[model samples]
Target: MTTHRRLVLALQPDMLAICRLEPTAYIGNDVLNGNFVAITKTDEELSIICPQENMPEEAIYTKGWRCLRIEGPFSHDTSGILASVLAPLAEAHLSVFTATTFDTGHVLVKEENLNRAIQILTQTGHVVRSENKATVPYAIQ
Candidate 1:
């Protein structure tokens, strides 16, 4: 039997950056000013994700990435959400970077591969929607 999940995913319209800094590095105004920013400090490094335009030069980061927002206020107990999203991508050999906020999950794939990622997801029975009409899923069966 094939199990299926239907999710409403929205692709964020802006390009994003993944920034990395020393563990003790100061968080700057630029990162804070980003439209959407996620920061994590571990023993080795401080990692940040934010709108590409707001990233500072001091941080070592990757640019030209786009995000897919899983639309939800998913219950804390919900299981397999990320697994469901990731399995097909893994099978297709597409690499993704993921993060989760209190309400939802964000998946980032390089800009060059966005269309292919959407096509792979749609083929696996997920709806991939974007800010513009162009990236809408074609047919999922």
Candidate 2:
């Protein structure tokens, strides 16, 4: 049986820009001080980015990108929220990445469409919270 708990939509402050730099995307020293980019040491070559003044010297190649996120206080059994969120993004032809903490779940969309995604979430009755703020308690995945 599925369980129901509260879920909210959240996002990081800056937009995430992604780059695929062979197998060595994020190995070198960060040229931009704390520019908020991540190069995953994964089997795949990928790095998600935010706005950085000093971009990499090696030409950063990007195939395509989208803003991705689902914020916390969400429920697995919530009838419409997940469906509601994903449906529209799906319709808009966007992809998503998801992570979970102790109390909530997180979804990540591309950086460009975050504003639109937040607008949709708010208009549909989900509350967005800042990292340092308090949002509702959700039993998330």
Candidate 3:
């Protein structure tokens, strides 16, 4: 069996919303102003993940998400990083939505599952720290 190294993830301090807009819809300043935002445009729709309080008025969204950022400046050829983290969560039956940037991966789990998710990750040997400096064994509000 191949052993994977434990990952360190940082929990962002903002409540987020995932929104879907028409593919042609214009993105506004509200989303751009968030401390963390991700916008993806596909032929079928435009998906936006941003701070819940900054979502556009016309968005069709699901609220109450918390983000976990996998610490990295991993090389482009790095493999299995995301899978290693996600596999354990999947085995625990936790639902997650993920996004990747040039440097790292981000996982978003609904607010109701945040504590359980953190527990599962830590139990699996990964370290989770909060951006707001909350101690380990996270007690996020």
Q: In terms of TM-score, which candidate is strongest?
A: 3
Model 2 residue 46 CA deviation in Å: 4.2
lDDT value, residue 118 of candidate 3: 91
Query: Regarding lDDT, does 1 or 2 come out ahead?
Result: 1
Model 1 residue 4 lDDT score: 68
Q: lDDT values of the candidates?
A: 0.81, 0.49, 0.87
Candidate 3 global CA lDDT score: 0.87
Query: What global local distance difference test value does model 2 have?
Result: 0.49
Q: For residues 3-24, could you state the per-residue lDDT of candidate 2 as single tens digits? A: 2323455444544444545665
Query: Model 2, 139: alpha-carbon shift in Å?
Result: 28
Total residue pair clashes for candidate 3: 0
Q: Please, what are the lDDT tens digits per residue for candidate 3 over residues 76-104?
A: 99888988888888988999999999999
TM-scores of the models, in the given order? 0.88, 0.50, 0.93
Off by over 4 Å in 2: 1-6, 31-37, 42-46, 59-85, 95-112, 131-141
